[model samples]
Target: MKEKIIIIGAGVSGLVAAINLEKAGFNSVILDQSDRVGGRVKTDYREGYQFDHGFQVLLTQYPAAKKYLNYNLLDLVEFDPGSCIFYHQKKYYIGDPSRKLSLLFPTLLAKIGNVADKLKILKLSKALKKKSFDDIFLAPETTTLVYLKEKGFSDEVIKKFFKPFFTGIFLESELTTSSRKFEFVYKMFAEGSAAIPKKGIQAIPNQLAAQLKNTELEFNTSVEHIKANELVLTNGKTLAFDYCIIAAEAWPIIANLKNQESAWKSVENLYFKVKEKVIKKPLIGLIADEAALVNNIHYQPIKKSDNYLLSVSVIKQHNLSKDELINRVEEDLAIYCDIKVDSFVKYFKIKKALPVMHTVNYMMPPSETQLKDRIFLAGDQLSNGSLNAAMLNGESAARAVIAKIKNGFINVN
Candidate 1:
């Protein structure tokens, strides 16, 4: 008889784990508390406009993504391999000259970075390309800020470009994220373009979830407790399984397991609909001012439409109400463009948007897939908090389960 597997939480990791186990000829059941399959990645439509839970982008060349996701089916919309930085009351364009040779001199001439800093970027790019992905992760680790300083990057460049860009990406202001993670992220950018599915980021997970053949999905069914031989559901029912995978975030898993918790960063996203396009091109505008209410603004382009969908990410989390925060963001954005505050379509405040990665814990061992007592864990926090890490770790845990089953169920504590 095929081994029975129960996977808790229907996020990307849980879904991926189920898919892999089913493909390997195991009977799998996926249980989720929420009604939606896409946990963090979700989209809502209202009044003829679409808004994601938060500002998100998919790197077209994420190594793990290519292994499963079909890029053509995603119908991706690629952004230019550049960014428009709003600095000192002016907008500056910094682009990859390699793709468009014409922008080589202009990007260097732009005030975003000095000649030396620009040269360092190219040097770092080439160096990263040469190093294997594993080597980059295992290299000497430190805070990203210190790593930049050690690499001879100028303060101007770190502040103007690196700080704002990374702050928006990592959802942190101190730039204390692991340098190794920074290296990996930079390598991905150097290799591919950042884009989103024409539908939404949810499309990525939805595509993965659609491939299950022998897996049973129980939506709105929460698992209260996990055990070595069975799972206790919130509705006072227990289901038996040979192997169980806990694929939720670290905090949720820690709470259930009664373990210490890790810190996470929050984000406040506000979406606006404009009558006409504000930024001419579909590019991200990094707010250079550190004290500003808005960290970055992305102008989402709709095919053959003059109307614009603006997604703004706010780094600071204040106790102010939604209207108050929206007012502040509108005031700051007015300096750059003429926008109506009343044009706001939706707002999303995500408390645990990103898992913080400090240098001290950056290289620590990933969460144990096979617990001493026979349980398993999977999530982005086990690696770094990225879509690629979540999917990869899920598959790794599934393989571990398969191997254990093949070996005839090891000793259980």
Candidate 2:
């Protein structure tokens, strides 16, 4: 008989881990607290419109994703190569000239940065491209702001472009995220196209879950406590397994283990269905004016309907009712675009959207995936907070478990 393994949380990491373990001939059962599969990456539909829980995009060049997912199956919708910055009552375009030649003149004349600052971006890109994936993170680390300053990026570019663009990505306004993550993300954007699955971002997780032939997924089941190889669920059930993997976010892992504290950032997304497309092309509109509540607006088109989808990433969490927040978002968005945001609105907030990695944490060796020989941890928190990182860590944890059991260190009944 194959060894029994219990995987907690049906998020991307957990689903990927189960798929990998089952491929290795292990009996894996996945348990999740929610009915849905994707944790932070999810989508909801209402009255012929779809809204993703958060503003998310897949980098087509993610190494792990490219290896695991069948790109042709996803049927992705690609976003334009660059972004349109709406600042001070004008539109500025900054993008790769090789991808879109039409934006060449605007990109050159845009006031976001000086000619020298624009040249620095090329230098930085070339420098990062020369470093291997492993070496990028291992290089000297500091705050992203500091690193940009050291690279001689003008304050004009950092404020008008980098701050708005990266804050939306990192969900933090100060650019205090580790420079390592910044470098990696920049390289990804430079090399690949940003896209969304035709259905939604949740489709990525759904694809992984479908590969679990030997794994049983138990939904709406919460694990009350984990004691060694024993798991007690909230519904007065206990199961014995040879190994357990806590493949969840930092908050849930901390809740179960009852220790360890890490700083996290929160983000709020306001979803709306506008009557028509706000921008002519499918692109991201960034708010260069830092004081606004909306960080960036994503223009998503809908098929078989004239209405289009537009979601604004709120700059910070607000303490207001649904109606009140919507009103505030409208006021801010009007200043950026010339369109009316319609009624069908939904508010989504994630308290721990992304883990904030400091300079010290970036330099330290990653926490061990194996804990106490029986339990293992896997998630983006253990690695960088990206879908690729999460899936990579999940696969790593499974490989470690396989190695341990094969070495006769873990006994299976």
Candidate 3:
């Protein structure tokens, strides 16, 4: 008989774990507290508008993503190569000239940085391209801010370009995230495009969940506790399993097993329906002003119409009410785009947008994946805070379980 595995959380990690286990001829069940898949990568459709839980994009170059996801089926829509920065009451389009020749003059003429700074960007890109993933993560570890300073980036460029750009990606105002993460992300960006599915970001998870051939999924089923080789559900029922994997974020329920507390970064994504597109290009717009509450903006055009859905991200939490926040966002938008507060539609205040990862790694060892004898842990928190990490760790945990099963682990039956 096949081993009965119970995986907690129907997120990316859990789904990937189940997929791998099924390939190994083992059957597994997935339990998720939410009503649908895509734990943090969900999309809600309202009146023909797609609202992703947070402002998210998939770097096409992510190795795990490339291996697992079918991009052609996703029908991705790519963002332009670089960002359109709003700095000092002016808009400047800075792009990668290597990708598109038309962006050459604009990138060179943009005042966000000097010629030397642009040269440094190319230098950094070349340097990172040659370094493998192992080399990047295994090298010295330091704050991103320190790494940039040591690279000789001018204060003007760091403030106007890197600060707003990376702040939106890191979900933190300060560039205190690990330098390893910065280099990894930078290399990914240089290597590929940042894109979204033509349908929505959630489509990525939905695709993965659809591939479960030997797995059963129970939504809205919460696991209250785990004792020995059995799981106690919140409904006062218990189920036995040969192996269990906790794929959710670090929940208090499993706190004793992991013995680690996790800190998270937060963000608020405010969406608006507008009659016209703002910032014209499909590129991301960064607010270079240090005092600005709005971090970045993206105008996703609604299909089969002239209207657009504007996604505005604020990386910090504030005490203002909804009305007050919208008003302030409008004031900030007025500085660069022709937008009005009346266009507001919906907003999501995600308190845990991303996990705060200080020490970063590409992947974790099999020994570290096991929380106990039969209980395993899988999530981005175990490695780095990226979709790739979540997928990598999930597969890693599955391999560990497969190894144990091959070594003559008993069948519960």
Candidate 4:
């Protein structure tokens, strides 16, 4: 008999698990608490417009993601060396000072004391690529900020570039994370392009889901529990399976698990559509100002025929109303892009932006858990948090189930 697998959460992780398990000759079904797949990689469309609340950027080099992405079909667009500008203490700079030619704009943006400071920045940026996450973390002498200060990065550069960039990426102002995560993210931007599927970030998951037409999908259905070899849904339905994969974010599904609960991390994101384009570079701008906030401005110029999309991220802050948040971001955008608030046409806010995967603070353990024999956990959080990490983890979990089925109900891949 074919081994049956029940995968929870139709997000990227779950979808990946289904595809791989089916390929290994196991039957699988996907279930998501939401009505659709692609958790953060979502695209909203209806009234002659398409928008993504959790506007995502895909890193082409992310290994597991690379395995499934079809550039021809998904319409991948590159944001290479996309004109980067920074807003620090209300003042802005046009480019990164680490480059030699960039120094010509020094007086405008580089608040460093002298040429030596700029040289230090150039040297550090070059050397950062060679260093691994372990080299920084295992060092007895430094925290992230301390390491930068020791490396001669001034308070000005830290506040201007690193802070804002990190905030937008991690959604937290403080660099209170494992150096590995920082290095992982920094390396992606440093080594490659930040891209989005021309169709939308949802294309990746949509493609994966399409591959599993033989696999049953229960959308808008929440799982109530998982037992020896079955899952119970909130709708009072029970599904029997040879194995189960819980790929949903740990917060909602993990706590009520039949076996165990996993920790979770949350991120907040906001999106706005404007009447006029604010920044020429479609993907540009960063904000790390005295207001104690940071976000990225994604001006959708390619979709110029439509509205300009400005997606902002605020990691730790909560409790602000939609209008107030949009107004503040509008003010920041105006200052960063030298545009006015009247340009905006519509706005939408989506909170809990991305999974914050660190060694602690809601970090999930691994793909295979203590109950590895029957139930498995998969997601970016467990995959150690990245499109690649999440997909890799899902593949790992699927391989495990496939191995069990192949080895007369034992474990492998």
Give RMSD to native, each candidate. 2.9, 2.9, 2.7, 4.1
Compose the digit string of candidate 3's lDDT tens values, residues 123-163: 89889989999899899999999999999999999999999
Better of 3 and 4 by TM-score: 3
Best by TM-score: 3
Model 1, 1-413: lDDT tens digits are 46677888788888888888888788788888888787788888665677888988888778778888899999998877777788767777787788657557668888987898988898888888787777887788888999999999999899989998899888988888889889988888888889899888889888988898778889999877655577778898989977788788534433455665777899999987666655566678888876677888986666225457788999876778889998888888877544554388789988878777654222212234776445677767778888888787788778778777776543322
The candidate maximizing lDDT is: 3
Candidate 3, residue 366: lDDT? 59
lDDT of 4 at 52: 64
Cα error, residue 369 of model 3, in Å, equals: 0.7
List the candidates' TM-scores in order: 0.93, 0.93, 0.96, 0.83
After superposition, candidate 3 runs with Cα above 4 Å error: 255-259, 303-306, 408-413
Q: Which is superior by lDDT, 1 or 2?
A: 2
- Residues 165-279, candidate 2, lDDT per residue (tens digit)? 9998889888988888999898888788888998888888988887778788899999887776788888989999888888875444434556667778888888877887656
Report the Cα lDDT for residue 266, model 3: 92
Question: What are the lDDT figures for the candidates, one per model?
Answer: 0.78, 0.79, 0.87, 0.64
- Give, for candidate 4, the lowest lDDT window spanning 10 residues: 360-369
* Residue 25 of model 3, lDDT score: 88
- A best-first ranking of the candidates according to their lDDT comes to 3, 2, 1, 4
In model 2, pairs of residues that clash are: none
Model 2: how far residue 184 lies from native, Å: 0.6
